[model samples]
Each structure stands twice: as structure tokens, then as C-alpha cells.
Target chain A: MMGLRLILEQVSHAYRDLSVLDGITLTAAPGEVLVLVGPSGCGKSTLLGIMGGMLAATGGTVSVTGEVAADCLNPLTYVFQDFALLPWRSVAGNIDLVLRARLPKAERQARIAEVLALTNLTEFAGAWPRQLSGGMRQRVGIARALAVRPACLLMDEPLSALDAQTRDLLLDEFAAIIARAGTTTVYVTHNLKEAVRLGHQIVVLSRRPGRIRATVRIDRALTDRTARDPDLLVIGEELWRMIRDDAAAAERERVDAPA
Target chain B: MPRLEGPVHFRAAGFAPKDRAWASAATLLGLLAMWQASASFGLIKSLFLPPPVAIATALWHLTVSGELWKHLSASLMRLFVGWTLGTVFGVGMGLAVGLWSALRSPGMAIVAALFPIPKIALVPLFIIWFGIGEGSKIATLAFGVFFPTVIATAGGVDNVARGLIRMGQSFGLSTGAIVRGIILPGALPAILSGFRVTTSIAIVLLVAAEMIGAERGIGAFVLSAGNLYDTDNLLAGIVVLSVLGLIVAWIIGRLERALLSWR
Candidate 1:
């Protein structure tokens, strides 16, 4: 499955008196991993939501430039921060849910099996979500998104919930999964190491009333780097230096503001 | 004498039932023994408190003559018809109120106003409306069961996590698909719990409705037996009601296990 090109042109969004995003223009090319990184109050998530059509920008155009393939199961899908899996559904059941409406019975079964294998959730196919570890549950979440053969996948801090060790382990697994799926993705996170490691193109946003700060391009192939790859770790540091001022300002604002 | 002490004395799995049947039987037998002693010793008047044996004897006689079946069949029939009607309509109205924005406010307002008023008191009004027959008796039970079911169903739907619904939308699931796949199963645990409460309410209202005017129900038999001073039959009828409640609870327990196995 190929990806869809998502374009945002001079987009602005506001919630009453508060402006969240402003004059932002970016393009996520087909099959590219565009990582959005910023401080806590930045509109990285809000932008991802707009791209996925979960939210609308208050001003300007957010458009998909490519036609969705007629055979594609879903044109776009969001992977939520909390995983958002139905607890009642087993891992296979969760993956099958997206395909149930459109696919033939045989195709649905095949797609569920394929995604389970791809996400390393084949062993957990019949296990309920409650029975899985946190990282495994998120694998089901990713598998569910991929079962659709979506053109674009939007993810919002999908690993923010795991402990440090799990997060470290799962980061490599996630990179491999996304690399194999080849779906255009807009990933949002505050973790700089994650940004530089997975991002083909990194778009940094400033704190509240978020606008583009810097756009960094990573030339390294995902297969060439492990989590401890020196070049990848250097880019992670570079990403931190770019956003450290905004993050520090946001922190001080939190300390100064009334509860 | 040696006493078991420390962790070895207690069962390793605290929740595991250990000789539960024996414990239950011993407690019941002890209670029956105490009751018989009181009656034989004349601590309480036999007229006021019939011994367990007298009650058991009356139950045996009623069962042999089919008198127990006569009262029991009528009450069960009413319960089946009334509870079925109430549950069907209650679930329908509940889904409508939960899913449709237009029905939500007005339907909730009507339910809130009607829910708290004693449904047993409405039996006299129902009798006047539907006559002193099975119609009035059934209406009382249906009315009593409907409100709570609606409240439970709507609350359950409300409590389904927002993220799951959003996930459904993200997957491009239709509204009907989302309701059937996500919302209904998500709400089942709460709705089944509501059934436990509604079944109890249904039984109580059934008894109250039967007491007022019904001729062939346990409630009516107990009231008439009291009037005739047949304490044995009266106690026998009360025991039947207790067993009916226990059966209803057991059915709900089985249903919860079957439907909510994931929980």
C-alpha cells in the first residue's frame, strides 16, 4: 500500500481567545515519515488531528493532494495516545473491526493475520486487550490501523505511557513497523530522540499559537541505525537544542501562572 | 490440643471456596435447630412464630395438592410478560435517548419525574384504568422495571469511553456499526448489573400488585391465609418468595458470567 500526500497551507486555528496554531504551511510527501515535535503547549497534536480530519483548522486549507486508491480499506487513520483499543475485543478482533465493513470474509481474515504478524502480535491474536502488556496493546493499536491498508497514519504520542525501559525497547520495534508499512505518517511527540530516530523529515513547532520553528531532514536509512547509533543520537541532541528555549519558557510560564 | 497457626492455617487462595456447601448447610441446620427449640420450649408463641417443621409441612401439603403451583404459575406468568415488555421498551427508549440528540432532554425529564414515585401506589390507579385483573398487576411490574432499566442503559452508554468512539470514527465505522460493536458491548456490564436491580424491583412490585387484588398469586394466598389465621401457609408463601428472589439473583449471576466474561 502507498501513501497519500497531505498539504497544509497557511493554516491557523484558535479556541475562543486562545490561538493554538498560526500561519503554518507544510507538506507530508507520500510514504514519508514526518515527525512533529514541540514543547507541551505547542499544537503538534492539534495539527496531526487536522491532517487526520479529526479536527478542522480555524483558518486556511488542510488538504490531501493525492487521490485515495479505490481498493484501499481506509484513506486515513489515527493511532491515539492511549491506544484507544476496545477492551472487549481480542487483538485479532480489534484488527478485524476496521475491515469488517468493507472486506470479504476471506480477505478480512487474511488482512488480520497479516497485520498481526507484521506488528509481532501473532501470538496475541486471540488474547483480550486487558491481558496484554502496555507495549503489546499499542502493537494491537498499530495493527488495527494498518489492517485498513491506510494511505496515511496519524499517531499522537503513542509511546508516552510506557516506562523508560519499555519505551526504549519499543522505539526500535515501532520504527521497523512504520518502515515496513510504508504509509505516510504524521507522528506527534515531545520526545526528541524519537523524533530524530524515526523522522524522515522533522517539523518543529514553537510553544502556543504554534508556528514552524525549523524543518530538519534526516538522510540516514532506518535499517542502518539502531537506538544507540551515534549519528541518530547526535540528531536527537540537535533536535533538543532547537526546542530547548521554547520548552524552558513554557516551563517558567507554568511556574509563574496561578493555579 | 494442637491449633493450626501462622500462614499455614489459612487457605492460600482467599477467594477460593473451601467446604462452602458444608458451611452453608451447617448454618441453615443450626438456625432450624434454634427455631425448633424456641417453639418446643415455649419461648415464643406457636401462633405468632410457626416452627420450621410446620412451615415445611405446609409447603409439602401445598405442593402435593398443587396449591403452590397454582399461585406460583400466575405470579411467574405476570413476571415474564411484564418484565419482557418493560425490558424491550426500556432498552429501545434508552438507546433512542442516548443516540438521538432530540429525544435526550425531554425523555430524561419524563423519566426523572416518573422514576421516583412509588409504582405500588399506582396499582390502585392502574386497577381503575385497566380493571382489577392481570392487566393492572402486569402494568405495575412493567412500570416499576422500566424507569430503572432506562436509567441504567443510558448511564452505561454515557460512560462508554470517548476514545473508543473516536477510534470507531477513525476506522470509518458507520454509526450503526459503532453502536453494535463498541457501544453495546461496552455498556453490557452496566446493563446486566441493572438487570439484577430491575429483577428485584420486578419481584417486589409483583408481590405488591398481587396483594391488592389478585386471586391466584403467592401474595394473595399469603394475605388470605393470614386472614384465616393459617400461619403455616403464610410462612410457606413467604419462603416461596425468598426462593424466587434467590433464583432471580442466580439467573443474573449466570448472565453476567456469560456476557461479561472479559471483565
Candidate 2:
């Protein structure tokens, strides 16, 4: 799939009087997976939203590279933390939700089937979200996004809602499916292991009123993401150190503040 | 590897109707027994409290003579037409107010201002406008049903998750598509529940409207029976009204089951 590269420049934002993000810049290369890791309230999600064009950065420009086809269903799509599957819709129906406008009836069915197979959700296509476990529901959420054939995917803690075991089990599947889809993605998470597992470029930000702390590039192939490489762990640890101090400071500040 | 587990369903079995029937039947039988004993022992005057047997016999004659059906049919027809009208317009207007920002406040203001006023108090106004025929009765029921439905429907729409709507917009879905795919179904549980309230309101309004200047409704029969002091027929009319309410509630229960199987 043709992917889009995103570029952010000196982005800063605030909610009325409360500041959230400071001047910061980053580039997500085409077909690259960029993960944003930071403490809670670091504005990683705000940055992701800006990149997805869902939020307008107050002071800077977020742009994309490469020509977008006029017929693209969505150049940017999001997979939410809550799965956000329409409970009334079946798995296949949920996937078809995004494809209904992009393709005709027969072609839409084919696309849903293809996404279901990719996400390993083919067997439960008729199942309602209420009938699926948390992990499978999130898979359906991913499948719905994939059916849009988005050039860029923006995810906000997609697996954080799952239990640790489910997150661990689905990590490999996610890496493989996303690898196959080949969409440029900016994933926001606080989990360092997940950041290292999926991101080709890990961009770390500091606490509230977040600013860039560090950026690390991993040269490992997507296939290698399936196994826990020592180098990846080292990079994960380095990334952790970058934010640990800021996270502790943020926590202390929260505690010391008036309730 | 993924766990390969079957889909986990949130299926819960509701109480069987058969299990519920016996308890209700017992309570009814015990009440009937007490009334029969009171009447037979003359603890209360027959004119004041006719036994269940007398009421049942009156109901039997009304049924055989088809007098009960005439009033029942008229009342049911008004309830059906009025509630259906109210629900249709209520859902449509609710969606309008819910989706379009321009209409939200004015519509809500109109609803809030009008909803609390006693609907029965407007039957005289409705009669003047729509006439003393079935139109006024239906209009009264419709008016009573409309306000609560609008509140419930708009509330349901407002409660639909903003995240899902944003997701739809991100997927390039048009407004209409988002409403159909996300909004309406999301609001359905609330909308269906609103019907429960609206139907009961409609029945009350129907009876009230029928009591005034009408000759063929259960309300009229009850009023006339009361004037003549035919306590048995008066009680029979009350019993018919109770049965009508039960039937309406039962129909609504069935509708909820059919429409909300997804939940």
C-alpha cells in the first residue's frame, strides 16, 4: 500500500489557559512505524491527533508528503483504545462500515473478508463486539481501520485496555499484520516494550506541557519484531531512562498539589 | 500464537414466563377469594362491593353482547394511531434536534416549556381545534406521547459516544451515513424505552379524552355505568381497562425483545 509521511514543525498547543504541548518537531517517514512514549498527560495523544489532522496545532504546521489519490477512503484513520466497535454491528459489519463508501457491495464484502483474514478475525466475522473478548474486539477495531486502506494510521493506546496476557499475545499479530499492511503509523503509548516492539522510530516526550526528550531509530526488520531482540530491549531501556525522571517529577507534582 | 478461543457472548437468560405466571396467578386468586368471602358474608353491602363472580358475570355478558369490544376497539384504535403519530414525529424531531446544532436549543426550549403542562388540560383546546370526533381524542393522546418521547430520543442521541462519531467522520462517512450507522442504533435502546412511557401516557390521555363528549370508549362506558350505579358493569369496565393496559405492556415487551436482540 502506498504510504504517507508526516512532518510536524514547532508544534505547540494549549487548552485555553492550560498548556499541553510546547514547540516540538518530528518526521514520520513513509511506511515507517513511529511510536510516541511519555508519561500520562505528556500530550503524545494531542501530537498524534495533530498528525492525523483531527486537531489543529495552535502554533505550528503538521503536513504530509506524497500525493494522495482523490479516491482514498481515508488518508489517515485511527484505531482507538476502547475498540469503539459499534456493538450493534457484527465483526464483518464493523469492517464493512468504513468500506461501504470506498467500494461497491460485492467489493466491500471482499475487502471485509480480506481484512478479517489479515487480523485473524475471519472465524468470528459474525460475532458482535459484546460476544468477543477484549483482544478480539480490538482486532476488529484494527480490521475496520485497515479496510479503509489508509495511507497513515494513528493509534491511541490500542492495546492498553487489554489485560497484560492478551496484550502480549496480540503484540506479534499486530506487528505482522501492520507490517503486511505497510501503512505509516504513529502509535501513542506509555509502555516502553510496546514502543520498542512496534516502532521503527521511538520519539520520547517529557511530562505535562510535553516537549521532545529523545528520538531513537531502530534498523531491525518488521519480521524481527516478532522476537525479543537484545538490542531492542537495550533501546527500550534507554528510552525508559529518558522519561523516568520526568515521570517521577510529574507524579510528585500531582501528589504535592491541592486536591 | 493467538489463543484461538471462541467468541465470548454476554448472553443472559431472563426469567421464564411460566415461572412468573404462577406467582401472579396466586396473588390474583387470593385477592378474588377475599372479595368473594366479603360479599358472601355481607361484610360489605353488595351495592358497595360486588363479588368477583358478579363482576365476572357482567364481563361475560358484555363480551357475549359485543358491547365490550365496541368500546375496546375504539380505544385501541385511538391509542394506536395517536402513539404511532407521536413516536414518528418524536423520533424525527429528536434526531433533528440531536444532530443539527442550529435546531438543538430552540427545539429543547420548546420541549421543556411544553412538556410539564398537564396534557389532559389541553383536551378542551384539542377538541376546539380538531373537533369532538375521534380527531380530538387521537390528538390528545398524540400530544401526551410526544413530549416524553422527544426527551428520551434526544437524550439517547446525546449519549451516543463522541469517539464513535469522530471515528465515523475520520472514515470519511457522510453525515447521513454516520447517523444511520452510528447515531440511530446507538439511540435505539433509549428510544425504545421512551415508547414504554409514551404508551402509558397515551392510554391515560385516550381515556381522559374519551371521558369527555364521547360515547363509544371504555372511559365513556365506565362513566355511564357509574352514573347508573351499576357497580358490576362499572367494575367490569375498570377490569377491561386493566386488561387493556396489560395487553399494551405485553406488546411493548415483545417489541423490545425483537428490536433489541443485539443488546
Candidate 3:
């Protein structure tokens, strides 16, 4: 199968009269990691939701692998920030949910086994979400998305819920895992450091109605570095400045608006 | 046994065995003593309320003569049949109405209107339609149980978290799979409680129906004893009914615990 490419052309989305995304255009090639960063309610997540086919655009086209309609991507999976694992299901059951449609019993078992090992979750297969720590649960979410073997993966602030150390550790693992899988990914977060660390191509958005403000390309070899690199810091600071200005402006707008 | 140490052991320890056993025994004795005192002191007339010992003696006599078994078996059969039918139809309809908007609006509106009409009020109609036999009795009991089960199950299914449904859809699950896998399990706790409520209603309706028109069963036995002023027999029959209801409820509670062990 051909690896996935996402192409969004002048895509606009609105909640009734309140427009969120306006005339936004972007693309992510096969095996590319596109990071979307903006202030809260700046339509970064709305754009991500549109890409994942969870929401439809009010205007323009979102083509996944040349499929014009979002629904055509039948197995487009997501890794949500909350790590929305069903509390009632065991770790293995959650992983199996994605593969239940296409794969037979044996193939499903095999795929689950492979992804469980990949995410280093083999020991906790039978454990419920409540029993596991937050980081471990997020790993289960990652394993669930990978188990689908999808053409593309969309993450909506997956690591934002974690503590600083856990977030950093998982970020490293996330970079390594996605690199090995080579699946096209669009990760949404407001954290500039995260955007700089994992994003091969970062798309910064203006405040609501959000539009792409800048797209920066990072060196792929940066993933090999153990420490926080100076290059990443420079890029993070630059992106932070852009995001801070927009966030302040958005806050001002919210305060000034009539209730 | 070696003495355990630390807060870990404290946490690991189950309920104190001595305290729990003693507490349970004391509770049972207290209830029995209260019943005996009430009946003996005539706070509750012995004709209306037999003491625990007198009820036990009456039970023993009835069991030895095999009379209690005959009445108990008949009542149990009616309860099982009516409850099973009511629960199955109620859950099925509830799931249908909860999942589908078209069905929910009209179907639930009708159920809500009719549910509170007093199922026993339909006894004369049921007798005319199904005749004054087991059919009429079972129908009354089943109808009584059905309404609550349907309402509860529908509410339960409706209350399932939307996040879980969205998650299931995103994974590309078919509608059937989503219902079977996510919706059903999500609603299991509420559905089980609905079943419990229906079970109680079925027992209540069964007794009412049996008392009105039936040759056998606990309620009929109670009615017959009342006419002869066989107060011991009447009180004994009521005791047996209470025990049967408790057993049924206990069994349902166990089933609920087993089924929802994952939760």
C-alpha cells in the first residue's frame, strides 16, 4: 500500500456563525511528522480534528492519500490527550479494539502481540486502565493507534497531561516509535519545546479564526541527540515568541467580548 | 502464624475475621429477638405476625407434610417464567429505543404514559382476555416487571459516555460491533440494577395475581388459610414468600457481581 499524504487546501471550519479555522492550507508527506502549535482555542485542535476526519470543514478540501473526502480514510486513528482508554477494558482489549474489524482471530492476536511488545506493554496486558500509571496508560494509547497499522496517525496533545519528566521521557519514546513505524503523523500541541523536539515540520497557527502563521523544517538527525540541543532551544524560543503574542491577543479579545 | 508488620500489611489485611463474624451473628440474633418480642408481647398480633419460632415450627410441619413444596414450587415457576419473559422483552425494547431516535421519541413517550397505570388495574382485562388461569397471572406479573426494566435500561444506555462511542467509531467499528462491545458493557451496571427492580416488581405482581385467582401457589394458600382463620398457615405462607423473594434477590445480586466483575 502507498504511504499516506495529507493535503488541506484553503480549509475553513465554523461552529455555526463562529468561524474557527479560515483558509488554511498545509500538507504532510509520507513518513513526515507535522506538528501543529497554537494558543488554546486557536483552532489548532479543530484543524487536527478536521485532518483526522472527526470534524468536517465548512469549506475547501481535505484530501488524505488523494481521497477528497475525510471519511474515505476508513482507518484513520487518533491518540487523544486524555488517553481515552476504556476504563472497563484491559490493556490488551483496548489494543485489540482497533484490529477487530479487518483482521481474523489469529492475525488480530499476532498484531496485538507485536504492538504490545513494541510499546513495552506486554507485562500489563491484562491490567485495567485504572491499575496503570498515567504514562503507562498513554503508552497503551500509542500501542492502540499503532495496532491499527494505519496510513496516518493524529495526536491531540497526547503528552500535555503528563508531568515534565514523564512528558520528556515519553516524547523521546514517541519520536523513536514514530520513526521506526514511518507512519505519517500530525501532532497538535501548544508546547513549543515539544513541537521543536518531535516535529519534522511544524505548522504554527494564529489565534481564532486560526490560520497557518509559519511552517518550519527541522533536521531529522536531531532525534538521535540525548540532551536538549541548542538548535531545538533556538527554534523553541522563536516559536514561543510567536505563540505568546497570539495567546495574549486572544486573551484580550476574550476579555473584551460581551458575555 | 508469624505476625505481619508495617502499613503494607495493614492495607493488605481483609476485614477483621472475629469482628465480622461476631457482628453478623449479633445482627441475625437481634432481628430474631425483635420479631419474637413483637409477636409475644402482642405489639403485633400473633394472628397477623407469627414469631420466628412459631413460623419455623409451622414451616417444619408444612415441609414434613409436603404441602409447602407444592405451593412454593407453583409460585416459583410463575415468578421464573414471568420474570424471564419480562426482562428479555424489556431489555430488548430498551436497547432499541435508546439507540434509535425514531423509536425513542414515540416508543418511550407511550411507555412513560402507560408505565404508571398500575399493572394490577389490568387484572380484570387480562382475566377476560387470557382467562382466570396461570396465563392471566403470568401476564400481569410480566407486564408489571416490563415497564421499569425498559425505562431503566433505556436510561442506562442513554447515559453511556459519548467519549467511548466516539472512540469506538474512530477505530472503524461497525454499528453492530459498537453496540455489542461498547454500549452494552457501558450500560451493564445500570441494566443489572434495572433487572433487580423488575425482579422485585415481578414477585409483587405474582402474589397479587395468584391471590385473586389461582388454585395453587403461596398467595392462593394464604387466601384459603385466611377464610378458615388458619392464621398459622397464612403467616407461614407469608414467611415462605418472603424467604423466596430474598433468595431470588440474592441470586440476582450474585449474578450482577459476577457479570460486572470487570467494572
CA deviation > 4 Å runs, candidate 3: A66-74, A225-227, A252-259, B1-28, B37-45
Give all candidates' CA lDDT scores. Answer: 0.88, 0.88, 0.85
Clashing residue pairs found in predicted model 1:
none
List DockQ, one per candidate, in order. 0.69, 0.61, 0.45
Tens-place lDDT digits, model 1, residues A136-210: 888888888888878888989999988888888888988888887777888999898888778999999999889
TM-score (chain A only) for the predictions, listed in order: 0.95, 0.95, 0.93
Q: Report, for all candidates in order, the number of backbone clashes.
A: 0, 0, 0
Q: Which pairs clash inside model 3?
A: none
Q: How accurate is candidate 3 locally (lDDT)?
A: 0.85
Q: Tens digit of lDDT per residue, candidate 2, span B6-100?
A: 88887787665455788889999999999999999989787998899999999999999999999999988998999999999999999999989
Alpha-carbon shift of residue B146 in model 1 (angstroms)? 0.5
Among incorrect, acceptable, medium and high, the docking class of model 3 is: acceptable
1 or 3, greater by DockQ: 1
Candidate 1 residue runs with Cα over 4 Å from true position: A255-259, B1-29
Q: How high is the DockQ of candidate 1? A: 0.69
Residues A37-96, candidate 3, lDDT per residue (tens digit)? Answer: 988788988888888777889998988773222322244688988888887789999878
Q: What global local distance difference test value does model 2 have?
A: 0.88
